[model samples]
Target: MAVRPILIFPDRHLSQPARTVQYFGPKLDTLIQDLMDTLRSTPGVGLAAPQIGVMERVSVIDFSRMKKKLKPAPCQDVRVLINPILLSGSGIQVPREGCLSIPDLLANVRRYEEVRVRIQDQMGAELILTASGFEALALQHEMDHLDGKLFIDRVLNLKTDVFRRKT
Candidate 1:
């Protein structure tokens, strides 16, 4: 597993819908490993295949530390999702969002406060999960990449809703 360079905005591949993984083969395994490495190396809570220039429906998220109780604990156990599909979501909430692809920009984007997702694990087993709060937002944000949508595209207002990162 190795860290891959994240594709920045204006890269044509970032706007293209990812191709679904047809088989769980060696290539898919390598991709998942590289994604995991790259996601952990980055500062963000989650990452997707398109961000790493792979046009596949793959993502990894680790939101355990965001919960009130888990705040004191070190985050381990990153969840890998391959070919994820949002089953449902509810209760719209506007959250401060940022993207690895669109660096240095943060935006207020409306996302589901709670969501149920169905995805295939690294072993190609189907898993269903219901997530809320920051985890839900992270999942929705990463899944959006599969459909060729970025958080910037969902910004409520460019003038007021967007912000620049402090350096």
Candidate 2:
């Protein structure tokens, strides 16, 4: 497992839709492990394959620890989702979001307040989950990468919703 460098914004690879994982082999496992390591190293809640320059439909999320501190919900272990598919999410809410790819830029983007998602783990076991609030937002944000969408694409207003890097 290694920490892969996250691809920054404006990269062409980030704009292209990711390919699905055809085989759940050792290479996929290595990718998953690398993603987990990279996500944890950044101390981030979620990460997508495109972020690490892999054009595959893979993502890992660890909102358990963060959610526990922010809410009173029961927390679970870290979750790694590969080829995640968003099923549904009800009600839209604009949240201020930041991206590792975008660096210091932050923006307000519209997202669902809650969501239901289906995904497979690193071992190819299927799991479906319902998430709300920040967790929901994070999942939506990461999943967007599969379709080549970024927080910047969802920015409510470039003049106001998007912010510049702080030096």
Candidate 3:
């Protein structure tokens, strides 16, 4: 597995909904590894397949790194969610976020404070889990890419809600 180039904003490929991952094999394992590597190589908490120019409904999330950027988080494992479906979401939080893809800016995106998702692991086994707070927010944000959506698309008001990173 390798660290692939993450697609930047306005790239048409980022705007297209990802196709379902119908087959699982060595290729799928490689995808998970690449995504995990890409995410680790950055400060971001999650990375989706489409973010790497792969149009597949798969994503990797590792909350460990966010312990320094955000608040102390409970989900520390590097997780791979294939064909993930958000089963339920509760509460709401508008967190200021930055994207590895849209590297130059930050934005306030509305995300669920808690969420439950049905997803498949690399072995193609189905599993469901609940997440709250930062983990929940990260999951929601990544899932949007699977639908060809971005945090900007969910911004309540671009004029006031959008922000640029100070760095």
Candidate 4:
């Protein structure tokens, strides 16, 4: 697998909703690996296929790095979520969020503090799990990309909620 270039903000692909992943096999496996490679090459914990211009409802998340700091890491291992759907969410959290696509900006976007999602793993097996804290936030953030939405889109006031990150 190779690390693919991420679609930058304003790239039309980043604004287009991704198609559902209908098949599972080598092609899908490669895409998931590429996403994990790409995510590791960057500073982000999660990534979506749309972010790489794939236009497929696929995302990869890894929180292993946060295991030591956080008692319960949302993802102890790399997780591949294909055609994931948010099932239920409760509570609220608006932590500052940033995207690899929008490299220079961060925003305080609202997100559920806890969420349960149904997703198909790399092998296309459906499973549902609940997440909370940063794990929940990351799940919602990556899922947004499948719908062609960015964290900035959730900002209530662009001028106030969005800020440029220091280089």
Candidate 5:
């Protein structure tokens, strides 16, 4: 497994919808590992295949770091979602969000406070995940990438809702 380069904003791949993973093979395994490596190397909660220039329907998320800070951690798990599809969503939470692909910019992008998603895991087993709070937001954020969307795309106003992060 290797840490792949994360495609930045303006990269056409980031704007293009990824192809569904039709086969669970070595290539798929590599993609999953590479994504995990990239996420661990970078400062982010999740990563999608397209963000690494791979237009495949794959994403990796590790919420442990972000969860540990909370009084009751949401979940300490690393997840891989392949061909992810949102089954249902409810509520709304516009927590400030940022993306590794977008660098230092942070924005308030409204996301489902709770969501149920169906996706294939690293081993190709299909499962449904119901999550709320930060975990829900993270899932939605990564799922957006499969549809070629970014956190910035959902920001209502660049002047007010978006701002550069303090170094």
Candidate 6:
């Protein structure tokens, strides 16, 4: 597995909805690994297959490195979600979010404070889990990619909610 180049914003591929993962095998595993490698190489906590120009409903999230970014976060080391479906979301939080694909832009996007998702693991095994706080936000963010939606798309007001990185 290798770290794939992330497609920048405005790439047509980024706006296209991902196809469901109908087959699980070495390719899927490699995609997951590449996502993990790419995510670890960057400062981001989650990555979607579409970010790498792979229009597959797959994503990887690792919150271990975000300990300081979100206090009291109970996130696991890493999660591989294939064909993820948001079953239910509760509460609401407008967190300032950034995307690796979007580069320097950040936005205050509306997301669920807690979410329950039905997903398939790397092995194609179905599982359901609930997440809250940063984990929940990350889940929602990545899930959006599967539907061709970016964090900026969730911004209530583009003029007011979006900001550029200070750097």
Off by over 4 Å in 4: 67-71
| Model 2 residue 70 distance off true place after TM-score fit, in angstroms | 5.7
Query: Clashes in model 5: which pairs?
Result: none
Summarize candidate 3's per-residue lDDT along 14-75 as a digit string, tens digits: 88999999999998989899998888888888899999999999999887766544444555
- Superposed by TM-score, candidate 5 places the C-alpha of residue 39 at a distance from the truth, in angstroms, of 1.1
Whichever of 2 and 4 has more TM-score, that candidate is: 4
Assess the local accuracy of residue 62 in candidate 4 as a C-alpha lDDT between 0 and 100: 85
Q: In candidate 2, which residue pairs get closer than 3 Å at backbone N, Cα or C atoms, i.e. clash?
A: none
Best by lDDT: 6
Q: Give per-residue CA lDDT, model 1, range 1-167, as digits (tens).
A: 89999999989878989998888989999998898788788777788999888899998887653534312322235888888899999998898888889889889999998889999977789989787767778889989999999989898689999999887
In candidate 1, the residue pairs with backbone N, CA or C atoms under 3 Å apart (3 or more residues apart, or in different chains) clash, namely none
Q: Give candidate 1's TM-score.
A: 0.91
Distance from true location, Cα of 59 in model 3, Å: 0.6
Backbone clashes in each candidate structure, one number apiece?
Answer: 0, 0, 0, 0, 0, 0
lDDT of 5 by residue, 1-167 (tens): 89988889989999999998988999898888899888999878899999989999998888785743323444458888899899999998888888999988999999888889998877788988888878888889999999999999999998999989888
What are the RMSD figures for all models against the true structure? 2.7, 2.0, 1.7, 1.6, 1.7, 1.4
lDDT by residue (tens digit), candidate 4, 39-94? 99987888999888899999988877443332376555777889999999999888
Instruction: Return the number of clashes found in candidate 5.
Output: 0
Q: Tens digit of lDDT per residue, candidate 2, span 1-167? A: 89999888898878889998778889998988998899888857888898888899998878764633433433255777777888998988787788778888888899998889988876788889888777778789988988899999987679989987676
- The TM-score measured for candidate 6 stands at 0.95
Which clashing pairs does model 6 show?
none
Q: Model 3 off-target regions past 4 Å? A: 68-76
Question: Sorted by lDDT, highest first, which candidate order results?
Answer: 6, 4, 5, 3, 1, 2
Each prediction's TM-score versus the true structure: 0.91, 0.90, 0.93, 0.94, 0.94, 0.95
